[model samples]
Target: MAAMATWFLIVIYLAFISLGLPDSLLGAAWPVMRPDLGAPLEAAGMLAMIVAGGTIVSSLASGRLIDKLGTGPITLISCLMTAAALLGFSFAPSLLWFALLAIPLGLGAGAVDAALNHYVATHYEAHHMSWLHCFWGVGATGGPLLISYFIKEHDSWRAGYTAVAIIQVALVTILLATLPLWKKVAAQRSMLRASSRPHHSDASVKGSNKFTAKTDREEDIRPSAQPMRLPGVKMSMLAFLFYCGVETLVGLWGASFLVGARGIPAETAAWWISLYYGGITIGRLITGFITLKVSNRILILVGPLISALGAVLLLLPLPGAITLAGFVLIGFGFAPVYPGLIHETPVRFGRANSAKLIGYQMAVAYTGTTFLPPLFGLLASQAGIGLFPVVSLLLIVLMLLCSEYVNRAIKRKYLIA
Candidate 1:
């Protein structure tokens, strides 16, 4: 059983890598792809919006979907769906087909992301949650590298898409073969939950999460929590909104900000921005190890301070090396936040509620990705790119406030318990 569990986790890590594989391809290949399809450069934004829309919609619905289909089936189906989309993209004749393919691509990604995150949070150690996400970072970072290499080697964006598609298809085969492991593991998990159900004391039962208020104590009143119908739900959503928004904003505009405000060369800015992402990837690896010794609470609370420091550096008229370090610091600081929040979900709320809440978190995260950067873009157009650091700082502060408040509420049992 232990060996089966390990194998299942390894496969899940690969699935996460596949989940990220197609994501960066569209952005990286768009420059060369657009002309072939007779599309304007600006059309990339529209396609991106379409993809984000699909992802958001799917993430919102993933809880029910996974509840019905089971995690293994959902993951396999989503991966297959994503692979099919990439295959279509490889041969897409026009921007229209690309847009059409983007829908399934987005939907596939959302389901896989939500399912695996919730599953890992419920089934594995906190450190595994951090490590699995680190694997995702690997995939996200690898996608662009693959695209670049394929484009350079074959001089066709189609080649890159095809290569990624093949990789996904191969992964799907491995997933199919591992179906028995998922079944056995899932059965074991069910038994474990059953065994643990009777072990809770009165204090724990206060947080039992009936989904409807039945307890005499439920009348004690968390007036604000009633609307969301869950304790900590609102704050969790807000935290996701700000964190993902900030993440998107930084990645989208970091280079532009460096060029515009810091007087860095465009090429140099791009290089440094790549390192920012690399910092995230590397930092998550370190965070996984850190999780072995440190609690998620400390990591979650401390991470934003580091990010804020990075933002302050960006705001300062720092020298060249310091400016670069600021970006890296932000990336490293952000590394543990998203995954830490995820790993803590089952802890904060009951396991029965974690799936739906995580689905909501995923949806909100995508919404932030979908809307925040563009809105900030509009503001930057008027206020100047120098507002980058200011905006980033504000977003981080909001996220940190939400996180800290939720933690306090949980501690006080002031949340929906």
Candidate 2:
């Protein structure tokens, strides 16, 4: 069973790769793609907004879908949808086509993300959750590199999209093949949990239907049926909102902060931002090992505090080297927070509610990803980018406070650790 679950983890990692592949392809290829489609470069922002909107909607609706269809079918279908969308992107002759394709692409990506996070959180160890997300970072980083290679060598962004689309197709095939692994593992987990508790965690396939069957009339989807009014739920949303806000703010403004405040070159600042993402990747790798020993609550609480230190480092009147190191510190600190929070949702909220709350958490996280950085940008424009570290520190503090509050609320009311 462990071995089967481990193999399933590998498949999930591949799906995460597919998830990451489409994400940066648009950004990297948009420069060349825009001219070919006769679209303005700024239209990328419009397409991005469209994609984000689709993702937000998809995430918000994932709980119902996952409950009915199961994670395996959701994974398979989501990957297939994304694969088709990406292939369509390769053939899109106009920005309008790209806009249309972005919808399914975003929806597919969100379903995969939300379903897989909840699946891993409920089924696997804390370390696996951290590693699962690290795979996402791997995918995110690989997309740009893959697209850049096609542009540099073939001089065609279309070829790049085709190449990535082909990869997504391959992952879809793998997902289709491994549908039973998800079923098998989930069945085992459900039985074990049933033995230990009284019919909790209905993350299994409902009554022998292989793929997508319209099975409704089951009341197992809701743990409480009213999780929205819970203090822990609200606090979790607030924490994710602030946490993701801090992360995206750093990514969007790191170079700007260096250039505006520290008088650094754009090229050099880009290198430092690379270091920042590198810190996140490497830090997640280390965090995988760290979670073996530490609890998610500790990881979540400490992550922001460490990020606060990084923000402090940026705010100090330090040397350029130290300021650059601050970005790495921030990235390292951020590494464990998101995954830790996701993994703890089941423990804090209970497994029966994991799907729904995780969906909410992811939706709010994406909402933060969508809006917070830009909101901070508005503030930065008014006050100058010198407020970079200052605002980051403030957001980190809010994230930490909300996260800690949720932890305590769960412990007090739910008797959860």
Candidate 3:
């Protein structure tokens, strides 16, 4: 049983890692698509926002669906839908069609995000959960590199996406094969629920055969206690929103900042983007290990401050090496925030509400991820690309404030020293 559980987790992690491929390709392919489609920079930015918007809507809806329907159906549906949407995107003829297709792509991605997150939160240990995100980081980094290779070969970005669509189809097949494992966990949960009910009378406890299947059914009909509400679930939700904003801002716009603001070549900008994700990948692994030894408050409070400093350095007229260092630092500093928040969510809220809480958190975060960066793009267009770092600096400062709030909440809840 223990080995089976471990194998189940491995499958879940693979499914999640696979999900990041599309997002990575989308980010890397933007520069090529913009020129091909005669899109303005803002239109390029809008492509990202449209996909994120779909994710936002679907994440919120998936939470309720997961609670009512369980993870198997949701995961299967999401994987199939995401595959179909990617196929649609691969064949899109115009910018308008591509943008429209992003909606279903986002929905499929969002559903997978919500369901997988819920599954891990409910079944996995905390340390393992952190490591699960590491797989996502791996996928995020690999996606861009693959796209870069195709772009170098003068291949169509459409072909790159077609390849991803095929991979998604295989992922769906693997996930379907693993459906029975999740059902076993669900059955265990149901048995646990049945065994925990109260006895009607003292006599019932003394092997009274009168307390039979009918009596058990009567007790099962009663509502269970509401899941334990985290003391600061609302505040944590807000922190997640800010974290998402920062993550998306860096991932989506950081390359543009390099190209438009710093005058780096498009190819160079894409490489730098990979470094940003690479930093995240390294940081998440390191932070996950660090988290096992350290408390959340220290990491939460200190990480953003380090990232804010990195953002400040990037804003300056530094040398290329120094600017690259800034991106690395920003990546490292921002790395632990997301996984840490996810690790804490299940600890704070009981497993029953984990999906809904994470859904709400992602929905709010996607709002910032989807909307704010385009506004930043417009700002850059108006004020100049040099303002990009300055804008990021301000967001980092806001993130610092949010981190402090989270720190205080952790202390109040006795989650930290």
Candidate 4:
């Protein structure tokens, strides 16, 4: 049983990493594609928004499918769809075709995102869930680095997509093979426990009859069929709104900041963008290891403060090296916030409500990602590149304030440790 659980986590982690690769490719390859596709700045920004929008809508549908179909089948479908979409994207004849492909890609990615998180939380230990997310960070970091290397070598971006497609196919095969083993292990464990205990089926029947009236009354007194509202839900939405803002801001604008603001060469700026995600990658792994011991509330509070400091340093007239350091800190600071929120959802709302809560959370967050960066880009186009960090700093402040409120709300609920 333990071995099966361990292997299950490993497979989930691999799927997450594989899932993140295409976005990383697009992020790193954007500079190259913009000119090739003759896309304006708005169109460039829309590329991300289009994909995020698709994910947002698909996630809502995915939650219900996950409940009905279970994780293994849903994961397989998502992986296969993702591979097909990437291949379509690779051969796209025009920007329109590319945009069209992003829709399915987004759907696949979003389905996997919600399904995997739910699976890990329901089936695995809490600490292992953290580790599973760390592997997601690993994939996020690898995407850009891999794409950049191929571009530098003058290889086709299509090759990158092809490689990821192969990986996804292999992951699907491995998961299908191992799933029956996991089910068998679970059944055996249940049987072993059953053998050692007096059967309670008859007692349960008698107790159920006695509790029938009480059960009806309890149901009447229970909260409405509407999802239980968490005090933090509103604030968490705002924080994640800002979270999407910050993450997309950095992912979309990091290279732009280096080139437009710092006067670094284009290729050099792309490489520097890797540094930001690299910090995120390392930071998530560290957070996963340490979060079990540390106060989650304290960690949440501290994250924005660190990120705020990074934004301040970026706003200064510092050397390129120093500015890069700032981005590194920002990446590390931003790393744990989103996953932390997702982790806390089940903790705050109970497992039954988690899918609905996460569905709404992801939808709103993607909406922010869709619009916020373009707003910054507009500011940059009109005002100057200097406004980028200033805007990000303001959003960080809002996130910090919301985090404080969210902590208090969690304490009030007292469901989570």
Estimate the TM-score of every prediction.
0.79, 0.74, 0.83, 0.84
Candidate 4 on 1-417: residue-level lDDT in tens?
A: 566656656777888876666656676666666677787655656777788888787777876897687667777788788888887866787899888988888888888887887666555545555566667667666766666676677655566666666766787788677666544644554565566653222111123222223323432245325653655778888878888777777778777777667888655666666777777778778877666566455567777888889889999998989888888888888877777777665444444565667778887887888788877777777887667789889988998888678767756544442
lDDT of 3 by residue, 11-107 (tens): 8877877767777676567777678778777775687788888888888788688878778878888888878888887888888998888888788
Instruction: Choose the strongest candidate by lDDT.
Output: 1
Model 4 error, position 39 (Å): 0.8
- Kindly report which residue stretches of model 1 are placed more than 4 angstroms away from their true locations once superposed: 26-45, 90-95, 150-158, 189-232, 253-274, 313-324, 346-355, 377-390, 410-417
Clashing pairs in 4: none
What's model 4's overall lDDT?
A: 0.71
- Candidate whose TM-score is highest: 4
Local accuracy of candidate 1 as per-residue lDDT tens digits, 21-79: 76556655554565689975446556766777888887778889988988899999999
TM-score, predicted candidate 1 vs. hidden true structure: 0.79
Whole-model lDDT per candidate: 0.75, 0.74, 0.71, 0.71
Q: Per model, state how many residue pairs clash.
A: 1, 0, 0, 0
Candidate 1, backbone clash total: 1
Encode model 2's per-residue lDDT on 1-417: one tens digit a residue: 667777878998888877766765664555456568997534655676667678898877788999999999998899889889988988988888998998998899888888887788667655677788787767655665666566667777777778877888888888888787787898886676666744221222212112112112222343777877765789889999888778766865766677668887544555566566667777788888776666667777777777899999999999998997888889889999898787666556655666677777888888876776666666766777798899899999999998888766655653331
lDDT of 3: 0.71
Candidate 3 regions exceeding 4 Å error are: 185-235, 345-359, 409-417
Q: Local error of candidate 1 at 356, Å?
A: 3.9
In model 4, which runs have C-alpha deviations exceeding 4 angstroms? 155-158, 179-230, 346-355, 409-417
Question: Which residue runs of candidate 2 sit more than 4 Å off their true CA positions?
Answer: 24-46, 87-98, 147-163, 189-226, 252-275, 312-324, 346-355, 374-391, 407-417
